[model samples]
Every structure is written in structure tokens, then in C-alpha cells.
Target: MTEEFLVAKDLRKRFGDVPAVDGVSFTIRRQEIFGLLGPNGAGKTTIIRMLSTTLEPDAGGIEIGGRSVAEDSVGVRALIGVCPQELALYPELSARDNLVFFGRMAGLGSRQAKEAAAENLELVGLLDRAKDAVRKFSGGMKRRVNLAAALMSRPHLLFLDEPTVGIDPQSRNHIFETILRLRSEGMSVLYTTHYMEEADRLCSRIGVIDHGRLISLGTPAELKSAIGPPDEVTLEQVFLNLTGRNLRD
Candidate 1:
């Protein structure tokens, strides 16, 4: 078995008095697509932020590739790519330019960054639109560019938070294909989404979190088996069974 690419032990984060991430723990193996499946406000984003090193955990530990996030944050940042829930793009800049800017910021030299930017844009099927200003692109196109930017560094571990949000079916499918291809090429992914179907389709294993705690962790089949699946089993059914039907809002 491949070694774990990411590990979180007793991860805890609080917002003033309320706990946002309450002692959640999980491990993601190398080259696997691991899903952080939960509903809105389920602390999915909070866990993601802490794992990405954008936010420090109040209590607990995070290790990526056996390096402590607290002790080697810069090294951790160098080894991972993050595509956040919100679009991070320069509206006035063309897609190619935006990617080049981000790549350079990630420590690549100018010419090398531009080349990498072009390659990533091609991977996302956006090479033809590389010269188009982001402000003029459709929402789906912009999201694709955002993804390309994150991959400019060719990181070993990629963090994608709600990458399919506001995207068309075609774009979503394309993104899913790209994710699988990356995993096949030995890139580990920590995918965060409220979309149950996406998790069912892409994840090698799923970790279900609700109220800042992980409630279930297993392969799709393992999870279904645990709950005693009927003939027609789905991730939605498994999720509802574990988290219940009450509205989080």
C-alpha cells in the first residue's frame, strides 16, 4: 500500500466560543482521491482551511508527507496546491497572465512559470481561452482557470474545495476526469464537497463530517455494507442515514 500523504490527528479549531472543528482525524493515502463529505456549515471548510495551512488549528496536529504543518509550514505549502471555494483570479488579467502570476508567486521563475501556466491551462481544456480576460469568461470558464492556477506548480497533493460549484455539467465532468487523471499520475487529492454524487463517483474513500466531527470513514462499498445496503444503494442514502434529514440551517 502507498504511504499516507496526509494525516490529521485530533484536529480542533474554535471560533470564539463555538467549536468549528472538533477533534476530527483522518488519513489520505498517496495517489488517492479522499472526500470530505458533509452538508453546508458542517465544518468541512474549517477542516479544509486548517489542512491547507491557511488557518492554524487551535488544538491537534496535522502532518503532510510526515512533516508537521506547524513546524514546516513553508515546506508543506511548497508540496501542495490549493483551489479554494471562492474564485481567486485577477479580473483584469487574461487567464494565461493570471496563472503566470500565481505560478511565479509560488516560486517559479518567469519563463518557467509561463510554460507551466500554459500546460495547466491545456490540462483544464482552457488553452484556447488562455488569452481571454477572466472578467469576460463565463462562470464555469473562470472556475476552470482557478483550477489551472492551483495546478501550475504540479503539486504532489492537491486540495480542492467545492471546485464544481457554479459550473455546468460539462465542466463538472471535465473537472472530475482531470481529478482522476491526476490521481492516476500519483497525485493525492483532498476533495471537499457537499455534492454526494461527486464523492460517490470520485473518492477512493469518503470521510463524513458533521458538527465538526467525523461520523463515518470508509470506502463507498464499506460504508454501504456497514449500513446494510438495499438493492438500490447510494451515497445520499448513506449520508442521510448517518447525518439525518434535519436541515443544518
Candidate 2:
């Protein structure tokens, strides 16, 4: 069996009177890509933040490679990389500079950070624009840099929250390819997105979260089978049936 790289048990979190995450539980195996599928206000981002150690869960346990985030947050942070839905970049800085800064924060030496930053930028096909400031780049270019920054530390576990949002088809495909390559190279990924097609294309298993609770969990085939068959039912139909068609604001 593949070793579990990430584990969450009865994870719970609340904001004010709203329960953002309630009793969520799952495990991601090494080299596997797991998708968290949900609509807006479904608590996807809340769960990502908790797993990345950016936000503490109000209750429950989270472990990354057997290290508890609550007990060893620093250790957990070092072991996981996160690319949030919001672009976290310094618009005034060059992509190289931005990556170097993030790498340094991850404990790389200044010279080593710059070297790694260049390599990562190249890996994401942004080497030509390495010296250009992010303010002058397009939305897709900025998103690429955002992902490169997260990979500076070469994290074992990666959390991507809607990484391909608002990008062109070419850029979106590039991001998808990058994610596939990472999993092939033995990195465990927890991806959160509302795109059913993306989930069907990449995830080994998907967990559907609705109103802060897990409503369903299974492989794409299994999920489609649960409703019927791939020819008879689509992932979007299954999602709608489970989550309902009501709009969430």
C-alpha cells in the first residue's frame, strides 16, 4: 500500500456562527492527486487553509507525514506547499525576485534561492520573463509565478486552491500538466476546485463537500457509477444531484 502523506480526522472549523468545516475526514496517499470538489461557500478554502497550517481548525486533527499541524506547525509548513486561490505575489517585483524571496523564507540560502527560483521559473515556462516585473505580466503569467513560488522548497505535499481560475485555456492546460508531472514524481496533491472536468481528468479520488460537510467520496468512475454510468451520468450532474442546484453566495 502507498504511504499516507496527509491525514485529517474529524476536522472542524467555524467562523462566527457559521461552521465552515464540519467533521471532514480523509487521507491522501503519496503520489496521489485528491480533489476536493465543492461550490462557493462550501468551505473548500477553509479546509485548504487548515491543511496548509495558515488557519487552525477549531477542533479535530491534521497530520502531514505523521506530524501534527497543531503540535508541529513549523514542521508541517516545511513539508507542504500551498498555492491559494488568491494570487499571492509582489506585483512590483520581478518573478525571479519574488521566487527568491519565498525560497529564502523557506530556509534556502540567498544564492541557492536565486538559482532554484530561476530553475522553477523555467520549469513553469516563465524563464523568458524572469526579469520582468509581475505588474506587466498577464493573469496567466502571474499565476504561473505563483505556482513556481510554492515549489521553491520542493514540498512533499502540495495544496492547490483553484490554481487554474481565470486563466486562458493554454495556461490552464499548462497548469494541469504541471500538476500531473508533480504527482508522477511522487508528490501528494490536495486540489480544490469547482471544475468537474478538471477533477475528472486529474484526481484519483474526489471528496464532495457541501455546506461544510462531506456528502460523498469516491473515484470518478465510482462516483459516476453511484448515480449510474459515465454514458448515462456526468460528473456535473452528480455534483448537482448531491449539492443541489441552488446558488450559493
Best by TM-score: 2
Q: In candidate 2, residue 113 scores what lDDT?
A: 97
The clash count of every prediction, one per candidate, is 0, 0
Question: Positional deviation of 65 in candidate 2, in angstroms?
Answer: 0.6
lDDT per residue as tens, model 2, 59-147: 99998988999999999999999998888999999999999999999999999999999888988899999999999999998989999
Model 2: which residue pairs collide? none
In model 2, which regions exceed 4 Å deviation? none
User: Among all windows of ten consecutive residues in candidate 2, which has the lowest summed lDDT?
Assistant: 1-10
Off by over 4 Å in 1: none
> Predicted candidate 2: what Cα RMSD to the true structure?
1.1
What C-alpha lDDT, on a 0 to 100 scale, does residue 46 get in candidate 1? 91
Predictions in order: lDDT: 0.91, 0.92
